[model samples]
Target: MKFSVFLDLIISGAFVLAAFLWYLASSDNAKTRREKGDDESITKAEIFKSWIIIILLCILGLGYFFSFIGSLSL
Candidate 1:
């Protein structure tokens, strides 16, 4: 594989990993908030936003990874 293609795969993998970690963090934060009975905690809108970000990141990462796979085949 070319250096650039390898780099792209690495970046895409990073993006996917970041998204997964972000999701886990968000879930843990919500659980902590619930357990603590915090008066001021993450709102529904914030949760929704986080989910959106996670989804977008996954989409971007997968898109790049698949495109690179195709290129490598050529």
Candidate 2:
């Protein structure tokens, strides 16, 4: 395969892995909050931050996919 294709695969895989790890971390954080009875503001902040990162990751992944498609020969 071409170098571009290989590089794209690597980057895409990295993005997928990063998103999955982020999800796991967020899940753990929520569990910790529940167990510790964290403040409402803290919980809200964590949720907001996690959502923003997840949304950004989704957008970046979609953008990369479209760009890869555009680069294809057919």
**Which candidate comes out best when scored by TM-score?**
1
State model 1's lDDT: 0.85
Which residue runs of candidate 2 sit more than 4 Å off their true CA positions? Answer: none
lDDT (tens digit, per residue) of candidate 2 on 1-74: 47786566567667767777897899789889978998968887897898788878867776776666666754
Estimate every model's Cα lDDT from 0 to 1. 0.85, 0.76
58 in model 1: Cα distance from truth in Å? Answer: 0.2
* Local accuracy of candidate 1 as per-residue lDDT tens digits, 1-74: 57997877888999999999999998888777778876553555567888999999999899989978987998
Q: Which ten residues in a row are the worst by lDDT in model 2?
A: 5-14
Reference-based lDDT, residue 73, model 1: 90
